[model samples]
Target: MYYIGIDLGTSAVKLLLVDEEGSITSTVSKSYAVEYPRPGWSQQNPADWWEAVTAGARELMAGVDTAQVRAIGTGGQMHGLVALDAAGEVIRPCILWNDGRTEEEVCFLNETIGRERLSGLAGNIAFAGFTAPKLLWMRKHEPDNFARIAHIMLPKDYLTFRLTGEFATDYSDASGTLLLDVEHRCWSAEMLEICGVSEAQMPRLMDGAEAVGTLSAAAAQELGLPAGTVVAAGAGDNAAAAVGCGAVAAGSCNISLGTSGTIFIPSDGFRVDAHNALHSFDYVEGRYHLMGCILSAASCSGWFVGDVLKAEDFDAEEAASDPAVATVDLPYFLPYLMGERSPHNDTAARGAFVGMRADTSRAQMVRAVREGVAFAIRDCVEVARGEDIRIERSTLCGGGSKSALMRQTLANVLNIELDLPETEQGPGYGAAMLAMVAAGDAPSVEACVGRIVRMRGSVVPDPQAVAAYEERYQIWRQMYPALKPIYRQMAR
Candidate 1:
């Protein structure tokens, strides 16, 4: 049996083919444009997603035995609001997850509606990216369109619909909507009322491994697959990555640093942080997970190396960065180029270099970018620790994990060992594993991971490095608090 996993990302749809043995046979990607009509607003057409996916799938299976393909799953960008009219036509370009256009709506829910009330109803509070807030923004700004709405879907659920002709979503994806009673694994009536939307507008809730349906004839012909290929209700990208890293067990963790960075911690039962800094969401393991998202992660490094520094030799620059200069406080940086989430949900926060000195060298500044990212990640770990989710070691995957300096810093600054997965395909690999479970090729997600997910090696923290990072981390924690007031003032 063969499974295909699609990672519906912010910039592209990445398709991966995995054989029964769990080896990735082939991988293909197709990019789509993200529109920014207004500052702080982001949108994308659902049609671009469909086209990329179908085209990518054809290429992914170009030389493979199509007859062996049995199931399809996806790890999708979460919390984008995709609306449909009565005839199932897209109402508008989806309001993407990183968009900040719903700030008014978020304030209404977090303040007027009240945080405690929202949390009680949805097991989470409103963030600008959440679906419920997006619904409010639409109702206020696009009332005519809201009245014509027949369906409200997340990004991947939209793809699932096009494939199986089923209006369905999995718990892991639904958890980001702020419309689900996450603890109960169902939509919250209170949330719907507050958002001025209806339950009928939402996709039918399905488990991540539940077979949404066999592919429709129309979809089959377009993608060159069997007419009845099984389509599993897939997970949000982070949860799927968790499944990929074998982080389904309690106390297990997976850190992904792609467009955004997150610390994912799985739990058997639902548990929300008292302050609501951490997001409590359903996991692909048929359980729950708590996640802290940093809006800027690897993108920060990409911007610095590829854009600002114009340096092609990233490895060479990393190698040139001396740890001795890292000891100086002259090159401190905060990784908030595109605003922040996770520990600080402030979208208005701006990036800064607090301790810049005339003596600061270009290499030290480069090292600061790497170290700053690691510090931001540790900020998330600090929030998790507050909630009693202890972390002595964690499995890591992401573009950032490939950097030896960053990984070593993560191990020491976060003060934990970082286990690296052998099949580091991340979310795409996990989505394929979900397909395996849906196809009945595996008993459970955990069982599938144990058999297929291999451990390559682990990065352990040296006592000296840990001690040094502890001092810097103490300083890192203070930077946010000292700068937070300025962040809000600038926003005003």
Candidate 2:
């Protein structure tokens, strides 16, 4: 009994092979290309994803016994649009989660369609990167292709379909599509009508750990795995990462800082914000979670160090930031490098350093990068607080979490203890755990997490620093709304 998890990411498909005991036996990754036809647009060929997965699977199990493989699960980037025609032909390259080409469609949904109505129907409002807006964008801009669509899919769902020969998706993935009634755990016909689509175009939905179907013959042969390997209904990348970090229980939180950053607060009952800011999505545990995401996080640091400063060694660059080490706050920073999402759904927004002076040092600039991400995340935490959710502590995992300075910054900024997981394998680990549960190797997702995942250590917030960030966070929330109209105009 073994399981393989495929993490279909923005740039690559990461394949992980794990035994029944949660030990990782093999790990492989294959990168793919993303095309940008326009400045704000991002797309990837479904063929590219399939090729990477097939190649990665072969590499991951080359020396292992493929016969022992029991199940396959996925954790993938959310809200990317993948379309196929009646004959199952790839209609076009998928629009990615970071694609901002659907601003017009997003405006029409949030303004004309009304956020309240959209939230009522789907438990969340539309964002430019959501699959539904991408659908509308296709309908408006690529009418010929839209006319031929027989099946609509998300990024990872494309992989699942190729593996299982089943046109199905999980609730967590569907929730980000702006087409699902997340509370009801089903497609919203009203939302479909609103988007000028129908239920026929959607896939059958399931919880993340449920078995969708067995692997197809072609897929099994390509990957050198058993033909009957169970393909579980996998989750969207964030949800998968949450489960990977064992953030499935009520009141548990996991912060992800990839190209985008998110604060995922897991809960048992369903809840939506009055402003429709945070998303209420179905969790892998058959429960619900509230999430808030910002489009740019660590990428801001990369940009500052690589592009702005023309420096490559980020660690060396960060180590120079003495101002952030003890008791001083950077005077200015706004890390909206690629617009923004969550509390501020402004695609027109741009990044800036507002209060810089002649005295601003390279270290201070670096510290600003660290502090800006923290302040932005705290914005989402405030929204969660307004909902009466209390987060005394949180689990941290991500590239950003690797920075001791950043971890300390986040811990204090949020005024909470940040715990690191024992098996912090990110999304792939969680997906493999889900596959184990579906394969009957584990009793449940919760049980498997309790058994396999452990807390390594904790980063505690300093009361003094928390007080400093509280003052800065209060100021950070003001800058966005004041900058909103400017962002809108710039988008035009």
Candidate 3:
């Protein structure tokens, strides 16, 4: 049997065709645009996502035996709010996950509503990127649109609705909404009330590997797949990627450096951090995980290289970078381009180059960008460490992980062994595994991953690099606190 997995990413829809044996047969990607209407706001059209997924699926299954396909699953960007009207039409362009337009709402929830109260209701406290804050932002600024919202879902669930005509979401994805009582794997009544949204507006919650519904006839025809193919309730991108990396067992760790960076630590049971610095969310394994998210990761380097420098080749830039200069304390970068999330929940924070000199070369800046991301991720690692979770090794995946410098930098900065997966297709590969479980080809997520996921190699931290990064990381930590006042002032 064949399974189709769709990764509804921030910038593209990646479709994968996998056979029962766990090998990716074919893959296709379709890109879309993210709109930045204002300095800090990010949004995207839901129609564009639908068009991309359908087009990519057709291309993915071209000349293949469509009848052999059994199930379809999706893993997508989490926490983006997608509202629909009564007629099931998109209410507006989706308020994207990286959007920082909810500072007021976030402050209202974390301060006015009280962090303790919010944390008790939802496993997490309010962040600007969370769905509840977005809802509050809409209610106050765009009341007409808020009133028109008959349905509320995350980015990937929007695709699930398009494929199966089902208003449903998986636990891992729902966990990010700040409307879910993540401990119970259900929507929180108090959170719903706080957001001024009805429970009816929420999607039905399911396990990541469970079937939401079968593909609708129209959707099947559009994608050139069988009408009755099962549609699995997929996971959030990070959760799905962890599963793909075989990080299903308790205490397992996975680090991702996609648009955002995250240190995902799976737990066998629910465990919320004392300060709520890290996100406590449901894992794809039907348990829990602690995640520390960095708002900017690979995107930081992409922006600096592609936009600012007007250069397309990242490898060429990295090749010329002086590794020796990276050890010095003069030049440092804060990867808060879209504001920070984990460790520091400051939305007013902006990216800055703290120290530079006349002789500072573009190569040195490139090295700074890469090392800056590594240092930011280490911030989250420290949080997990505070919770008494010792992470000695972790599986790594994502666009940034493809960089030898990044992988080694992360290993050295965090001082952890980094395992490289054989097939690092990210969430799409795990979404396909979820499809296998939904179709009864696999017993569970654990079993599916056990059979499919394999470690191809590992990157061990260099002792000298680790020592140098330890010093630099301490200095990097001081930069954020020192700039907090300035960041707030600049926001005005």
Candidate 4:
């Protein structure tokens, strides 16, 4: 039997074909453009996603036995608002997770509605990227479109609807919407009223590993797949990635350094931090997890190298940096290129190169970018530590984890061992694991994860380097607070 995992990302839809034994046999990726209609307003047509998925699935199953494919699961970018009218046509371009146009709505929710009340109702504070604020934005700015909304779903959920003709979403993905009472694993009526939405607008909730529906005949024909293939309720990208890294059990931690960075800590019971810095949400495994996200992680390094330096060879540039410079007093690069999320929910926050000297070299700047991201991750780890969550080590995955220097930098910066997973496909792979559970190929998520997820090696922190990074991190921590007022003023 075979299972397919579709990761509907911001830039692309990645499909992974995995067998019952947990080995990936084939993969396909289809890219799409993200529309920026205005500054800080990111959107994408839902039709574009369907187009990519159909094209990618055909390519992924070209030589494979279509009859053998049993189940399909998806993992996608979270908090995107995909609204549909009563006839099921998309109301407008989806407001993407990275969009910052909900600033006014976020302020209204966090300040006017009250942070304490919001947190109590939804298990999280309002951030500009969450779904509720975006809904409120539409209600205020695009009331005509908002009024026509009959169904609301996340990005991946929309794809599932297209495939199975089911309007449903998994708990893990819905947790980021600020409309779910995450602890109860259901929609919050209070939050729904506040967003001026009804419960009927929300998708039916399911566990990530549960089968939402079978593939429709139309969808099967479009993708050249077998009809009646099981479609599992998929997870948000981070939760799905956690399952990929075998972070389903309590006390398990996973750090992803993709376009964004996240420190995910799984717990058997739900717990919210007093500061509300970390997000308490339902995990893909039906428990709970705390996630701390940095808006820009590897993307910051990408911008520095590709845009600023006009360099394409990232490995070579990263290799050029001297390891001995770990002890040197270097400039700090705030990795808030797209503002910050966790701990500091400041959308006005901007990236900066502080303490740069005339003598600083390109390699030093590169090192700074890496160190800055690592430090920002450390800030998140500190919040988890404050909650008494002991993270001695964590499973590391994502594009940034491929860099040995970055692995070492993160290990030292966090002063913890970082384990590299054998299959670092992240969300796509995790979605496949969920498919396994839904298809009865695996008894449970934990059992499936244990059998599939393998650790390759560990990156241990150097004592001296950890001490050096500690001092540098303390200095870097102060830079954000010092520049906070400046960023707000500049925004004005």
Which number leads on lDDT? Answer: 4
Tell me the lDDT of model 3 at 20. 92
Error of 4 at 365 (Å): 0.6
Better-scoring candidate (lDDT), 1 or 4: 4
The ten-residue window of minimal lDDT in model 3 covers 321-330
Clashing residue pairs, backbone N/CA/C < 3 A, model 4 = none
> TM-score: which is higher, 2 or 4?
4
Lowest summed lDDT window (length 10), candidate 2: 322-331
lDDT of 3: 0.92
Which regions of candidate 3 deviate over 4 angstroms?
A: 322-326
Clashes per candidate (backbone, < 3 Å): 0, 0, 0, 0
CA lDDT of each prediction against the hidden true structure: 0.88, 0.87, 0.92, 0.92
TM-score of 3: 0.99
- Model 4 segments more than 4 A misplaced: none
What tens-digit string does per-residue lDDT give for candidate 3 at 198-288? 9999999999999999999999999888999999999999999998889999978999999999989999899899899999999775689
TM-score for all models, in order of appearance: 0.98, 0.97, 0.99, 0.99
- Model 4 lDDT per residue over 115-223, tens place: 9999999999999889999999999999999999999999999999999999999998999999999989999999999999999989999999999989999999999
Instruction: Encode model 1's per-residue lDDT on 150-223: one tens digit a residue.
Output: 99999999999999989999999999999999999999998898888889888999888878899999999999
lDDT (C-alpha) at residue 462 in model 4 = 89
